[model samples]
Target chain A: MTIHHQSATQLTRIICAGDISAYEVTTASLEQIQAENPNLNAAITICAEKAQAAAKRLDESIGRGEIPGPLAGVPIVVKDNLCTEGVETTAGSHILRGHIPPFTATAVARLVNAGAIIVAKSNLDEFAMGSSTEHSAFGATKNPWDHTRVPGGSSGGSAAAVAAGWAPISLGSDTGGSIRQPASLCGVYGLKPTWGRVSRFGLIAFASSLDQVGPFARTAQDLAAALQVMAGHDPHDATSTAYATDALNTALEKDIRGQRIGICPEWMSGNGLSTGVADTVSHAIEVFEKMGAKIVEVTLPKTQEALAAYYVLAPAEASSNLARFDGVRFGVRNEANTLPEMYKSTRGTQFGDEVIRRILLGTFVLSDGYREAYYRQAQRVRGQITHEFESAFADCDLIASPTSPVIAPLIGAQTDPLAMYRMDEFTIGANLAGLPALSIPCGYSDSMPVGLQLIAPKFREERLLSIAAAYERHAGQPGVAS
Target chain B: MPDITSDDVHRLAELARLTVDSARVETLAAELSDITEYVQVLRSVTCTVTPSPHAMSSVRKDEVNPSLDREELLNAAPHSDADGFIVPRVVG
Candidate 1:
């Protein structure tokens, strides 16, 4: 296989065995990105010189007889939201156009420490507020499978980067369905780890509680390898869990035989679920059944309500989290005579329409006379949804559903804000419950990819990975878009 | 849920420190109203459970760790100097 087409694990093995230099792999990845990025728009900032330097350093270490890290010599893409020291991390927003972070995100740093070379900073929705990359100020990322279609967002560019063979693995942040939905649309494996599984130290905050950094890869093994490095505790982020993550890659070797996978009927037949996606998910379940896995019909009545609660809760947190971007600190500043005028002018003119809409919604929900009815009620509903997931897990090891309700839509297909919000109907439940969820290609619909979403209880990423690996083995790896 | 009027949008913009353009106020109002109305489905949900926040874990002991270089941070600011970040004067 060509260097860019190989998975992270394979590339690492090849580089470590002295068959090829890390510099060679990094060069191939940079070449592919430069050639395809113009058409795909998957990458916002390509770091060719930096990546080449990092890869050369790794090759020199190997030449000096130093053992390579697990992800040695692998090329990776990171969503622009995750800060990279000295790199202008725009987070797909015009406000942050020239802002260079002083520190790298913990997850990105971990990947680099493990010898993964970052090829580029991929695009995302503005502050991860929208479900499509169309919200990006840098311009929308086209799906690799079909250029006219969107590669979902706010991590669309990361997902498309992997699917288009620009990189073996990429990092993306999931707040609602940002990671999984885009992973689905791009026909790659994307995981939204249990909320605190990965640190959020330098990730540009959209919703502090809901945002999580995870990986997108063409293979489950690549996802496992990426997550193994990205997971664990960090003192910088108090919310990061101290749980053990050593079992992730090892668990992928185990089969899914005798595992009980839960199927939520409400989600299976949920509103707006396209018939094509439904068939693809059903077929995926049947494949699991054939692989000696038991399929249980589980009821999660509150799962439907998670979408409603997530919109309120995520935006509410966004309004507060985004308050830090005033003209004083960093990023673009629209100078005005007064402090208040500057704050208004900088935020009002810089933030995109979706961001403005979300800020307004968040402000409205938290406003006087509306807090108790909207924000507080949404929190209560969030609690109920969490409780529902906890109860559902008692009956099954993992819950399976369609990752996205529909295939990738045309770039300008969805105009209504509400219609765009509904794209996350199935994937929002996992984020609401703070559980580990993965989306892997199950089949094709309308000649585009459909993702089968498997959600496991908190800190059970191993189960999600192992089951996804097993399914990938049986279903065969998804084809890379030519 | 009542429709979010342009007046409501203006009020929200003021509170959020966002300037709503006169040309976009009507469109913004309609969009916000649609989202709010759609999310009103949460109102029908009978949520008796107390809202539990995400549990905090592994909070490190309070210690003075080496902080980022002030010069680097200052350099990233739009207006900064040897002292600290500079902002528009708020008080007379």
Candidate 2:
């Protein structure tokens, strides 16, 4: 069997059944990463020795008559932003190039505890800043489907790694559609849980309130398996929710019959939406209807404002969160005669254009005289957007939309920053409302994947996964680009 | 639409503690202006959005927690001595 192509859930079952050693699975995953990484640029740091050591440990444990953990021996990649103890965690920026995290993120630690092997660290936009991985100081990750096109980001590398078959599952962080947009462009399943569903102990923060670590996988069931391990509270993160995550895997078995799927006309027919996307979504809605689900038109009139609000609010938060990287404590430092000069030159040279642009914009908005006009007003609009979602959810069990307005653009097709920001329009609403949302491949558009996104109210991951699982079972899994 | 002047750009950069190269200042000014203009749409919107109770109010109880040892943390620092992180003199 092609072990690397198997889903993480299936690989675990196979490994536990003694059909394959965990070491063999890890080897195959490592080999795949080595083979595909040059063309895809999906992984920024490959951990062959560490992965082999981990796999050997798991295999020995299973040989000792021990019951394998939930994900036993599944090879996974994590976005560069997530800290891994003893391994370099760059967050795809030059500032932290050689900085090895002393501790691991709670989400990655939980996955490791569940018996998953970490094989590599995937690439992303610098500090998870942009819609495309082009913002990475390393280099942009190319779309596996079309080399000229980009793998959507800032979780672009995680999604691309899964699509390229380097690993069956990987982790990504979504502050504003980082996970889902990339997952859509790559033809995989990505889930952004309720804001506090997954702990953010060591995730390099871009926007604290909106950022949540999520899983990207080839199948919804595999995504559910990952979430089973990742979701829960941590003493380290006060924002981590204590919500019960039991029965999430079991919830995948439920059907979507009698469920109300909301379709917002404003979102579906919004500007920038291509005919290919609209047609693909229309067909997906029909699939749900055929399965005895009801489709209803719901209103979220404030949907358009979400994009603007996210930009303001996210940058405002980022400006504060990123102040820690000043040359003194950790990471790269440039020499200067004075401490303040050291800070200015170190940051000025290390941060990428997009990161600096955001920092400056954030400073401008949060500046003394302009706070009311920009930051405060954006916060109010964020509340209104959240309220719009809550009101819409009252009439529907789940809201459905295209994960992105259009297919993945060519790698350099979107040089203008505002144009790139528009790519996340369809997916940012969930972030604003702090809702759980899933993006699964609906169909192909221009040969690229078109994602049908299903969003549920806060803490309703079970609903999102169940619906996604039902759709995947019927439609069959989307094919990866060769 | 708000025009972001070169002065505004420099002031914002100073506040952010980020040095904007003179060569890139003009481009940054234009880009910042575009973004600011785009976000200005929110100014016309009026809605009552209360702060989320859980988001604003939730805090873990102050408690003892296991933390990374000092050596491991110091190892990642740019400059450190036996005492602690070494930096340029703070006292002028």
Best-performing candidate as measured by DockQ: 1
| Model 2 ranges with Cα > 4 A deviation | B53-58
Worst 10-residue lDDT window, candidate 1 chain A: A299-308
- Tell how far residue B27 is off in model 2, in angstroms: 0.6
Write candidate 2's Cα lDDT for A326-350 as tens digits.
9878899998888888888999999
Error of 2 at A104 (Å): 0.4
Candidate 2 chain A worst ten-residue window by lDDT: A299-308
Give all TM-scores, in the order shown.
0.98, 0.98
Model 2: residue A129 alpha-carbon error in angstroms = 0.5
Q: What is the C-alpha lDDT profile of model 1 across A379-403, one tens digit per residue? A: 8888888888889899999999999
How does model 2 score by TM-score?
0.98
Q: lDDT by residue for model 1 over B1-92, one digit each (tens)? A: 67999999999999999898899999998888877887888889987677688988867888888989889988888888999988788889
